[model samples]
Target chain A: MAVDNASITEVVLGGTRGGPDVKTLREDKWWKLPLVTVLGLSAFVVYATWAAVWGDSNFFYLPHNIISPFYSPCLAHACKAAGDTGSPVFDWWRLSPALIILVFPLGFRMTCYYYRKAYYRSFWRAPVACAVQDARPGYTGETRAPLIIQNIHRYFFYAGLVFNVLLTIDAVQGFIWPTLHHQLVHGQYVTQSGGFGMSVGSLVLCVNATLLWIYSLSCHACRHLCGGQIRSFSKHPIRHKLWKFVTPLNARHMTFAWCSLFFVAFTDLYVRLVASGTITDFKIF
Target chain B: MADVTMRIWRGDDKGGQLVDYRIEGNEGEVVLDVIHRLQATQAPDLACRWNCKAGKCGSCSAEINGMPRLMCMTRMDQLPAGPVTVTPMRTFPIIKDLVTDVSFNFEMAKRVPAFNPPPAPEGGYRMAQVDVERGQEFRKCIECFLCQNVCHVIRDHEDNKAHYAGPRFFIRYAELEMHPLDTNDRRELVRERMGLGLCNITKCCTEVCPEHIKITDNAIIPLKERAVDAHYDPVAWLGRKITGRKKRSADEAAALRP
Candidate 1:
């Protein structure tokens, strides 16, 4: 049967109608996804805010020198010497150390391809699921001001790489515990010594760094960086190989995104507990 | 004799429900074949839209067992031992038993600017093998609207239909923008009017694509990158301001020479 071209044109040109005719009739567990996303993102936001502002217990185990991921590269001059090993590059601001660097990582997550879908559905109700109707009257899309910033995700990916390097350095520092060996050299006595050993804190930081690396590498931006620009995959054998390798990870970008998010928070919490003497760091030789 | 139960949707715009029909199955039958059988033996007036019984035409797209698939491509034997449910694409307004009003897609197509290539050179315009291949991947689109139906931007959000152009046209825009000999600049139109940013790269469109087009990675994301480079990049933004607006390159002008 031939499709009525005239009718199709009439309907096509007919301007925006109201909402959908049917809301949804899906009987199987539709609410679960949005509920989990809302609760998960809300918890992360709350915890991150509290942790950033609490200030005192962010740096723990001064003698052992295991710094929290949140306060790493602590730039405030007022920060205690234990976590301030990176030195205060900008001493003007004495606020929460996380405030300065948190934007980079947070921007990375907020603008992430997967997370955008997660939050858009959960929070914005931009069609919560496959057959569900949206609550909004009109769809403005990302063409306008704030939403358009999402396009800058590739730039955030670049900034995220810098953070990954700094975090990896923190993880390496976890393995080197301070020893009690102080001697006067010139006019100064070195209060701490360093040796290679593993602590539970070190393991936590290591796992955090590893998960983050996987998450960042599996990013859509990174996948695009690897091969999206190439016109033909056959000519550039190396880029083709890299794109193929990243494809599987890119397929599971959502899994890595969530796992890395949970692990980052867990790592921060572990350091905070150890710093506050709430938990003991088990050392492993 | 092996038999299969087909629960086809029977409804219209106001409301509808599933109606079951039991039919005898053959060795290598597809869902469309079964539907055809049902039309022959059981229900004569049972309405559904289809042209080519093959998958190439993309006219027989429907949700088979709750997943978007071409009815002609979905094999009966591949389905599990249960009643196979067939329904019209959920994104559009149901017109009858299994047909949807897909005019929303045509409207979006109309809204996009037509491919405006520069005037041809003396003989004809020359295109490199690589440049042609880049646009070729997108040209394979059959306008199945499966990508449009599956996209949550317009699928779930009914209002989004006005602003968003869905995946089908994103590839169209990508095809025109990526063409080497084409001189029109659609980055601004793509970003502003076409609502390119509405897509968050969920890859839902890619998953449901019958042609296996890389809707998210190749077309959508690259188009997004171009939009960002033209509109957002600090360096590009500075260059645009300093250089004023860009005219067609000398090579592009030469290609258009009569």
Candidate 2:
């Protein structure tokens, strides 16, 4: 067989497989995922302390900001009825706390290439993940439990990405809206953001979303799924350019996985800070 | 010299039992050397398969002391202080003692189509170094059948044999798909018909691979993604519609005439 040594080098071990730039992140505290996770949780302690001294917030600036344009009744006319009458009531403090915890899995889910890789590598090999010799016969059957959840990563990715976009939009709303005081206005103690927590929350959310987006979009499986078009894409000028943007993210999909993981932790921190009131609801937008 | 105990499975499809033998060992002795000693003196009829016991050819796929290990590479001292065990691969049928019917692997190999190269350009073929690098992971496959033995698709669903082609074949499929000089439309074949959908991406094959090939990340999952793109991506379908005609014409001209 006239095995081309060039082909051997190129075909077997080429492309993103040999990128030499893994020096910075792979060797850091991140690889100690346990420590990152512990510290990530520990950040919550700081958040809790900050919240207890201050007070929880409900950052809703511009109380009349349109939440659901589609549901509003003023769309039929010139629509000049906006005076804080129809905006949906929301609790930014309560929501931020809930969102903090919810965002971790979302970020992990968004950028998780390892889930699929591990699923196929670890789960597929079954009871024989390791081989035995001269001992009792090994079972060659499918393994069960949490391992089986590997199949739905695609769907999970979709959910996390969508939630990221939605949360970013929420962050945007927080930026544009105004904060509230314990307005004895209607005497119901109706709390809302007249000018407080929304701006910082929105900024935090944007950074959080952008990082998570990079991590999720840079995923290895996503790259492969799209890379199928690499050959045909080479000829098309437009797709070729688009794929270039995706290439770096796709190349270091694992890096994105770790980056987005920490971002999610940071996102939860931001959400907790906003909700718990450790950081004053300056609503600085 | 030190004494080491071994439990060897000795039997056929009809019946089977573990037979023990004690052997003297020295430091730095390889498992293959110990097995050779056992075969030379005591159990002459013992059947085992090996070639290039240096770990290059990948022929010595066997489980050692209940762990899938290459007998050629495993050292006796690395094992726990007790009787070591040896057996044939589990996914494949037992052919005899310490040897299973691995012909299923070759049979699967036979099912894979021969590689077909794309048409040469008028000036000749060209490919980038960066483009061809990732395929090296696929090409290094030693055909140890360790991947096949470790695959849950084969181990869990023996009935999967009818529908599935297992991990090694996926490596083959991924290699061809990623080949810079090759031309084939095996992605849809691998995905829909070859049971690429069945691989949940556990990474057991990659973990056990002595070559350290990232079988799951570099090969199988990429192949699966190709399949998904081929089958589902509208843009890919469009690209194929645009380019498929030219490639098919070129392939027909260069490939063997039917």
Candidate 3:
């Protein structure tokens, strides 16, 4: 039987359609896809800027109050006994302020796997989005600039990994210190100083964050993994392990990407609580 | 079932118009199959380019309606039916109906310096096995030029042609950069002359690739890293000076480099 014009139909028409001169106007070149990307990035700036002024300052407090929670829990108890509830309001202001300062970089952050993929598709054939050029097609598939930022994703992977490990260390410190015996017999809420177990646990959280960062950075299947490198891979002992670990991370990069995002927030939260007093840093004698 | 229409662009650059053709085939039938039937019964003069029909060889590149694709792999069922359009590669000048001048890529390939390995006669250069494997993965590239077909540097802005070498060129640069035995320094050539920084790593080429090469990460990215190391990293600068042997540049022989 002969197929008629009525029998077949075009399926797979890509992207949303609607423009002022839909039929007459040609698709725009070097299209800047106003995705949730640029706008969503701005949200980080707004939040970060607000956090600088309104949030806690304790995030910057490094190994001092934090390390004690892990190695010696009893001190937290003593500090808590001597603590004033009014400090929490000050602590909140201490921790979150710098994160607010970091908004500009986040907005321009080039570590996005999604942006890499979207632009690859967009510019290769549709720098004009999904719209096609009707006037005699005279184009070659290639990429253009601003794509230069892809170099940073690798560094981001390394930096994020280190940062997440530190965050986890901070969380573990909280759990560890709570287990330690506070020798502050004079304190209201007395507790014992935690043993090596708590210390180990805190370390585990730090390592957990590190793993999340590895997934974010080494992601092989993510959009950033789209290009080719000139050099063939060498079978270095360290390089081999990195690839194996990164493969799974790359396999589910999106999951880890979101997880670390929340992890960062959680890190900020713990610091706020210790500074504020809602979550007491009690000393056990 | 409705009849599927194909408005094929027929003619050389002199002038042409959309020539319509109709054929009967299953929805899943690839666009190449439709063209085959058209060849058998319709206008035989209708020119097309193809090879392994399995989406390999990178031979069957054309724009269906306006999108670049391997006609052999495109399914008839997937396209809209008002008039199923078939045309040649747009980036290059047309040779005839559905055939474009893709020799430009080949010509570009000629400009790339050929590979010259380290000249240690006794111990052929001891490269770590891991490093060799890294290069082999990118070496799997089949030169589909699909990445070239999809790049905006060539597609939207024609002016970039002078300075911007397409992704395929970068792949060549990358192959040399990773080769264990290669000893030519193409980093400056790739960065300053080849325009390596122009690629944003969107990976459109990898997406369109039939060979499944990781065009961006495996090739373009490593090349970018090399450029960085060449220009920014102190250790690499010293290493290059002491070695006397230049870093590897390409896999081709001396005749290949333009």
In order of listing, the candidates' clash counts read 1, 67, 95
Candidate 3, residues A222-261, lDDT tens digits: the string is 2223222223345344445555555555546546554554
lDDT of 3 by residue, B1-258 (tens): 456787787887576677888767765788898887888888888788788888767777877766667888788877765777776666666777887777667656656777767668785568776676666766766666767866765555455566667888887777776676775668777776566766656556776776677777667766666665666455556887998745443332322353
Which candidate comes out best when scored by DockQ? Answer: 1
**Top of the candidates by TM-score:** 1
Give the Cα lDDT of each candidate.
Answer: 0.75, 0.56, 0.54
Encode model 1's per-residue lDDT on A175-260: one tens digit a residue: 87766457332233446566887888888888988888899998888877786545455566688678778878987888999999
Looking at model 3 chain B, report the run of 10 residues with the lowest lDDT sum.
B249-258
lDDT of 1 at B13: 63
How far residue B48's Cα lies from its native spot in candidate 1, in Å, is 2.1
TM-score for candidate 1, please give it: 0.78
Best by lDDT: 1
For model 2, the DockQ equals 0.10
lDDT digits (tens) for residues A141-197 of candidate 2: 212344333434555566666666765565566455545566432223446745434
The fnat of each candidate, in order, is 0.19, 0.16, 0.18
Whose lDDT is higher: candidate 2's or candidate 3's? 2
Clashing pairs in 1: A60-A275
